[model samples]
Target: MKVAALDLGSNSFLCLIVEGDKSGIKKVLSDQVKVVRLGQGVDKTGSFHPDALKRAKECLTEFKKEIDRHNVDRILAMATSAARDAKNGSELFKIGEDIGIPIEIIPGSDEARITFAGSTEGNLKGDENVIVIDVGGGSTEFIVGNRSKLHFAKSLDVGCVRMTEKFITAQPLSESEKQAVENSVDIALDSILSEVQKYPATDVLAVAGTPSAIAAAEIGKFDAEKVHGFILDQGKLQKWCDILASTSVQEKIEKYKIESGRADVLFVGATILHRFLLKMNKPAMKVSIKGVRYGVALEVLRR
Candidate 1:
């Protein structure tokens, strides 16, 4: 069967088409990433901006045509943090309905499970302890499990875009700002950390853009073969944070190749990643390219 998976995320909207098989699946058509910032200023307002909603609706409308062209067996579309918390979340759903694609809002635990499924396909050992973290635009999912079972799973309300809008003010932010964001990440992880210790995993699997960007940066400067699942050292991450904090937004855009829109929040994202590693006591983490989209594709295979 062919399936179309739409991920309505806080930072970006993604549509993936896949062909299901007994072994796994194959990507057929995957195109277009509309960075609509759907969760714009959601941290302060507790709701999605009206403009963000309209832009998201517009993007989904165009995606529907592509889905039809692919002639997929079914459409499995889901919304993440923003849609789950926004005051007008229902309104966004209604807009999706208007476009003929009904969106499913997934809870954090479920999100964590799906992310685990995607990450462990080739990386996890049958008996090893592993933690899979998905850093989305609006929330981050942390799951501890192995090949056979999920010991712990949770979702935190900390994400790159959310942190950017909330804690970052200046282009690169000051030293105090970096410390403030780090402290906030520690505070945010407190409740989740209490649960994480109960299931203590050995290997940490980091997912989503922030980790991916760090991996890319490492690869761009180093060797790609030595890069995948590379342990992100706290010292390196801290250095990046300090550098980002000291630089201007334009500097980040030019130096790091970060999207102009995302440059403002890159420091927060980088800081959050580093702090998470410190709290987990894991030295190195494997970066996974597969994440929610792969999970969405896997859902079709299971069906």
Candidate 2:
């Protein structure tokens, strides 16, 4: 069967189409991503912004066209943190229905589980203890597991979009603003550190935009093949944070080639990952291009 998985995240909307059966995926038909910032003002306003909604609808329209061209046998669409938190988030489901796609708002725990499954797929070897970190736009998820079983999973309300809106207001963040962002990340991680410590992982695999963006910056280009399995150490993350903190958004876009929607929040996002890595006592993390969408596709095949 050919299956399509749509991930409506706080910062981006992604679609993955694959030809697969119960054994495994045979071929990847198409993969598309658009930074829609669907959680634009939801952190503060508690509702979806009109402009964000418009962008989401337009992006989904495009995704629908792509799905049609592929002639997918099944499509499973799920919305993450943004839709889960927004007061008017249900409207997103209505939009999906209108577009002939049904969108389900999944809880954070479920998000963590699927993220672990996807990020580790094709990567994990026998009995490897791995921790999968998904630093999203509205929330960050941590999952500790081996190749066969999941041990722990938690999603915290500390993400690029959320932290950026909450702490970073000025371009080239002031010392105090930077401190504030770091402090908040530390506090958020404080709640989960003990639990995470109980399940020590041999390797840390980071997924989603923040790690991908950082990997792209490190490689000087956005190539999935290179980005995947990339190693990002604490020193490198701190260096990128410093570079992003000093540069203007335009410079990040033109020089660093960061996505327009992600440039502003990139610093905070990297900081969150940095703090998480420090807390985990790991020097570096391996990047994974696969994420929730891949897991969703796998789930659809199972059903």
Candidate 3:
């Protein structure tokens, strides 16, 4: 079957089209993304802004055109974070329906499982105990497992956009603001600590944009082969977190070559990623370009 899987993320819309079967994927037809920022101001507003809805409409409509070109057998799309938080999420759903791409709002718990499924494929080794961290714009998913066995999975209400919206007011945040960002991540981690303790991970795999940007900055460019499977050291994560947090967003783009909209919340995202590594006491993490979209694509193949 030919499949198109959509990840309707808070900060971006990603689509993965693949040719695959019940056994596995064979060819990747196309992988595309657009920064729609669907969750813009959603953390405080609890509703979709008119511009956000317009962006969603434009994004999904364009995605449908792309999907049509593929002649796919199935199209699976899931809306996360912002959609779940917004009161008028249905407005975006209406756009999806009108555009011929229906949307399903998935809970964070499922996001964790799907994230794990995506990150682990071709990355795991012989029943290795692992943790998959998926940091998004509005939420972060912490998942622990051994091979295919999911030990613990939880989603925290801490993310780059959410943290930035809640506490940060300046480009170079004050010391207190940095601490506040850290505290938010820590508080969320603490809530799931007991459950996390039940399953200790041997390897850490981080997915999504935050880790991708960090890897690109460290590598001096956004090369997929260089970034994917890159082992990001613990100290380096902390180092980048502090450095990025001390600079303005434009500076991040100019210095790190970060994508424009992504630069704004990267520091907070770095903080979330680093703190989790520290909490787990892992020395380094492997970065994967595959995330929830990949997992959803796999699901379409099997279904």
Taking all chains together, each candidate's TM-score versus the true structure is 0.89, 0.97, 0.96
Candidate 3 lands at a TM-score of: 0.96
Task: Report the lDDT tens digits of candidate 1 across residue range 99-141.
Answer: 8887898665577677787667668766887888877788878
For residues 201-239, what per-residue lDDT tens digits would candidate 3 score against the true structure?
778889988898899999999898999999898889989
- Summarize candidate 2's per-residue lDDT along 206-290 as a digit string, tens digits: 8988899999988999999999999999999989889988888999999999989899999988998888888888899999999
RMSD of each: 2.6, 1.1, 1.4
Give the alpha-carbon lDDT of every model: 0.77, 0.89, 0.86
Q: Residue 49, candidate 1: how far off, in angstroms? A: 0.6
Badly placed stretches (over 4 Å) of model 1 are 221-231
Judge candidate 2 against the unseen true structure and give its global Cα lDDT, from 0 to 1. 0.89
| Model 3 score (lDDT) | 0.86
* Candidate 3, superposed: residue stretches over 4 Å from native: 107-109
Clashing pairs in 1: 229-286, 231-284
**What is the Cα-based TM-score of model 1?**
0.89
Better of 1 and 2 by lDDT: 2
Given candidate 2, what's the lDDT at residue 168? 84
Error of 2 at 144 (Å): 0.5
Q: Clashing residue pairs, candidate 2?
A: none
